[model samples]
Target: MENRDTETYPLLTPLNHRQQNQTTTVVFNAESNDISPITGAGEFAREFLVESKKLWYLAGPAMFTSIAQYSLGAVTQVFAGHVGTLQLAAVTVENSVIAGFCLGITVGMGSALETLCGQAFGAGKLDMLGIYMQRSWLILNATALILSLLYIFADPLMKLIGQTKAISEAAGVFALWMIPQLFAYAMNYPIQKFLQSQSKIMAMAWIAGVALVGHTVFSWLLMLHLGWGLAGAAVVLNCSWWFIVVAQVVYVLSGSCGEAWTGFSFKAFQDLWGFVRLSLASAVMMCLEVWYFMALILFAGYLENAEVSVDALSICTNILGWTIMVSFGINAAVSVRVSNELGASHPRAAKFSLVVAVITSFAIGILLSLVLIIFRHQYPMLFSNDPEVRKVVIELTPMLALCIVINNIQPVLSGVAIGAGWQAAVAYVNVACYYLFGIPLGLFFGYALDFGVLGIWSGMLAGTVLQTLVLFIMVYRTDWNNEASLADERIKKWGGA
Candidate 1:
């Protein structure tokens, strides 16, 4: 092993040496030299242990933060359910359809930061993290302005899609109240990816924890106690998300991020066109995935028993959302690891990290799936008390459990693609598998075959399974060494290295 000069390559502490101008070479042989079986096995164990520790170090906190933040809406929905099934369905449509559309775009656009910041941090180009974050914020906020129109017109749109008048009108009112959350999404995602790149997730977790607590208190006071109803829920939800945004902003400005927060600059504006293009690709990729499921809710609204179908589907999706958060944590962790290692010219390390993360996340998915199956009958009570809704949820439990397992593995692969800056390619894959193939199959089963909600979900799950397999193959065939060189080039092109 070569000795590294800490001053020259401060972030590559674990790597043996730094690559200069994409020309310097470092050898990393994967094959074991030891002839003794015992010695090789011992070395492999140590390596696995070390990688697992590094993965969980980031994943544990990231998962907690994701769950805490996601719970804001979940908690609101729970409160709405207790208010009435009508209130619950209204909130569900607004959330799953209206807000969900904007979330897909904003979070997707902001994910461009994950690629930029993760690689920049790995390459020891800390200053680029702040600039990339700013660039993402600009694009996402502008996009939010356009998406606001959706919230404004959610009522008519819901009705146009065959939703009941009562549900549409109520959901529209809730949608209007939740517009502030759109902008909050714009700011929050970039800040998250920015901090995530540098492994500054503990602060994010803390902030989210505080926000969830504050949100619950205010939700109780305004919604239940003060009789604010949906209005109260919306108000508290908006405040809680913005609170997170403001808190993260304050943290960044306080100089806690060192070189990564050298204040704002004009550089954020320098590469607007280029940024928009990547942001758009990312937006499309994520929008396809997020909207794919949002379609389930939309389709459910057209069912005979619209309210019951929507309510029950919403509950299943909510449970899926919670489980997805855990997978997303692993997704974020693996993305950071891959990009950082690639940026630091450690191809072998990046590949190892992906393997470990996939194994860990898949195991978690299996465990959660089993738990949901074991307690399937009881879990829907948390979201609804209506017998019809509960019965429908029970009927859907098997499909939901299968979704949990597939979705868990899917996000991890998506993370790998994101880390490798393969958003453009993945966007096309999502289109083919989700829209062209999955949605049509679902429509056929759900309507043509009269399988109902179960049929629709089964079709969507098939798409997810196919998409997951495609991503798995893409990851399997990736040439890590070539990817490392590409990361170096991307750093130089964008980070001015």
Candidate 2:
């Protein structure tokens, strides 16, 4: 009745084909080496799990390293704050404003190595990582020399920017004392990018962790016990940073990053201009994003009730900056993941990696936002005892929470662009949306419309919206296969595998 002719023919099932011609039934077992056919949904779920595991492996260590190093500066400020309000003002301006600016430039310049070393490693040209890092040193050190002038003249710049004379002079002295740290920053960033490309992130994490512990103890000793004030705090913080750098250098030379770090060569001096162009794009894109937030602080200072507004906004910025570092770590992870897959000629894998990274980071962002909202009133006690500042902070918490979510998503997308070698394009988008449109809108809302700090913040958020939209479109329209082909050609052009 059930098609006896076909039954007699015994539809030759592929699974049972090796069996005798007689009718046979095959059953799949979980313990068996053979895999049964999977449904479409099942395949997707499986791949998603695999990709999530891979992403977290890279992101976890990166986040730890980033937060630990970030704390070095934060800890110095804490020590200085306990010294006196004047000392706190000096340390904050020097560390948070001027140094933060130089940091953006240095770190952004080093990230070009992320693209290069990442692809080179993925293409099995391990030795190039060392050359790439050495090249970064040559470029970054030269850049650091130019940046040293910024540290040397911090007082006049602060004064010109309308900072109080007393605070500006003190901060300037503090800035020059911290100048040695600039070279440390220059050396550290490239090495971090190089090792990260090779999946050696744990070394960076552990080194930073150790340096942070040392930083805390020394901060207490130097700033409090020794009563050395701002100068002592700056010196200790600089030493703490260099400690991390020295440890990283040891890790590379100890053969932990073998092959990827063949001894440094003069060849790093070759084709320098091409590296500079890309490095400049990376720097511009990053600085646009970094300076955009600094503008928020600058605008907040002029709003009505300037005292409360600035204090509340500064507290919010500190928390936001700390949280954004998590997203930054995830950004680094995704950049490495996408670039590596492209370099390895696996376009689909690159696409999958990007998807996994965004989903994972977005989920974390949501959790962070929820926590910030829930604890808005309570957490202000960590940084402020002033009742008025706390109230204002609570008022602004919701907007800040939402922006936290956006911060997480946008950086990961930027990382995608970086992996795809789209820095120059993203730089243009950032400048247009952030400087040309966002800052002006914020100024209009805050000053002309008299909307105060919230108005200014809303404008900054609008800029983020435009920048994120452009990134989405760029990433959406990308032909991954073509990008993979381009990565292959790039490696060959660089004399890699």
Q: Among these predicted structures, which one has the highest TM-score?
A: 1
Can you give the lDDT of residue 227 in candidate 1? 89
Global lDDT of each model?
Answer: 0.86, 0.78
TM-score for candidate 2: 0.89
lDDT: worst 10-residue window of model 2: 7-16
Give the residue spans of candidate 2 off by over 4 A: 1-39, 304-308, 492-497
Clashes of each: 0, 0
lDDT of 1 by residue, 201-255 (tens): 8999999999999998998898888989999999899999999999999999999
* Collision pairs in model 2: none
All candidates: TM-score = 0.93, 0.89
Candidate 1 to truth, TM: 0.93
